[model samples]
Target: MHEERPEVGVGPWEGELPSEGHYDPELLSNGDRRNVADKYRYWSMEAIVADLDERRHDFHIAIENWQHDMNIGTVVRTANAFLAKEVHIIGRRRWNKRGAMVTDRYQHVRHHPTVEDFVVWAKGEGLAIIGIDIFPDSEKLETYELPRNCVLVFGQEGPGLSEEVHQNAEATLSIEQFGSTRSINAASAAGIAMHAWIRRHVFDQSV
Candidate 1:
């Protein structure tokens, strides 16, 4: 006898169908196996995004995709986890989305052809661009008080932050690493930086 595969999401609505506009009819009838929270089980994609927008965080996430970085997707996923206002992709318009695991569907993403274009947009939106990378002048992320309305920008995997982005950033920060590696992975570093921001702004912790 063959073993039955375990189902992912709910099988279907067991009772009367909801009349809310946000509910997805197909998902309700078939199932809702998407990787979303229980609160958004049967919600439409547009409806889920709309509801998230109501309480999105003040900070944004920007990444340089000069090399079509694979880490970009993971960074975007982290931004979604943190409820970032939006994600700005710089350098390359197209990126690898495998690491995002479909979180990008719920996250708002924008593309900028170059660093200059991204800087202009950030300034126009009153978002200070804070770079996350190691540099001569980079400060410790542990001590930094990230601005409430800033964008945490990251660089591509190998080269790290481009000179253009480094020069334009309001400040660059580095995470403390005690291991053998010179630096952590770009995606890992991004998550740490974003969590640092959350700790200060969301939890009111300075360190």
Candidate 2:
């Protein structure tokens, strides 16, 4: 049987009581509690991360950061939710952090000056790089054999994958499109790719 574990911090809160109260006014009255699982209720970010670190996923996530895209934060947040092994930023060292909602502190993120550097690092780690883009001659994502240990690389919002990224990827995949638009939002696409991986490897056994 699985042993019941304590929620939040390693130990219960211990300190002199404040004149105001136990809970912060801003967090309590404003209803600023997190949307995480019940186990993390009223927990600090540090506690949540410690729990997540004990059971992270195997796959890694990487995005082309040449444009300093605001979408990077959303991607990081989603990656954190899925507990991805790591997040790699290719190109620019800095990106818009507003979308990440302060979750970056809990996730492992790496910066690469260029796509070449990312590819080199991934190869060194025995991680196969898979590019998600709707380009000609690309394999259909639904049918591709995603590796258990791999990095899913996404391009910028508008232009899609860079030439260097395309050339470096072990395989390129395209999501089927039915709408008039050429592609979907970068963050949405990343979520879809991540879910597909989860379904293929993580969920198959249950079904």
Candidate 3:
């Protein structure tokens, strides 16, 4: 559940209202943004993020950003929704943020110049790294035992996991594929892998 904070008055609105304003004053005056869930309505970005940080999940999310994939934003948004511990970007310095809708501010994101840097960090943190790919000799994600505390790694949209990343993975698992397409979208694949981890380790009532 989300927690709400009391609003702090920064200042009064200064501009005169336009005849045909783009946004509703009632919503804007109350800091209500329709892009977020109801629980976050009328709350400042910092407040929402603080609330999320207080109850974030254990799993981390990492994506290869070599192609400037727009899907990275979607992945970040999903990670925020699921309350991931953190989001890591590997292989590129910049990614398209338009799709994230500024949700990145509410999610902790780290950047690694290469896959090796990410692997090193994961090892130091004692977090297992699981690669999501459809390579030969890879295990089926459905049957694999996902770690309760781990980094879920995903590759670029078309090329999939780089050789170094595939080799560094504690284990590589593939989602079931049946259509003519050789693989699914990277963002969609990430959502699947994250949910699998959640179902296996998190959703269990005894936890």
- Local distance difference test, per candidate? 0.93, 0.83, 0.83
- In model 1, which runs have C-alpha deviations exceeding 4 angstroms? 1-5, 205-207
2 versus 3: better TM-score goes to:
3
Models 1 onward score TM values of 0.95, 0.81, 0.83
Clashing pairs in 1: none
Expressed as tens digits, the lDDT of each residue in 16-87 for candidate 3 is: 643432334554464453467766654556667777888898899999989887789999988887889999
Q: Worst lDDT window (10 residues) for model 3?
A: 17-26
- The TM-score between candidate 1 and the true structure equals 0.95
Residues 33-68, candidate 1: write the lDDT tens digits: 998989999999999999999999999999999888
Pick the TM-score winner.
Answer: 1
Q: 1 or 2: which has the higher TM-score?
A: 1
In candidate 2, which residue pairs get closer than 3 Å at backbone N, Cα or C atoms, i.e. clash?
none
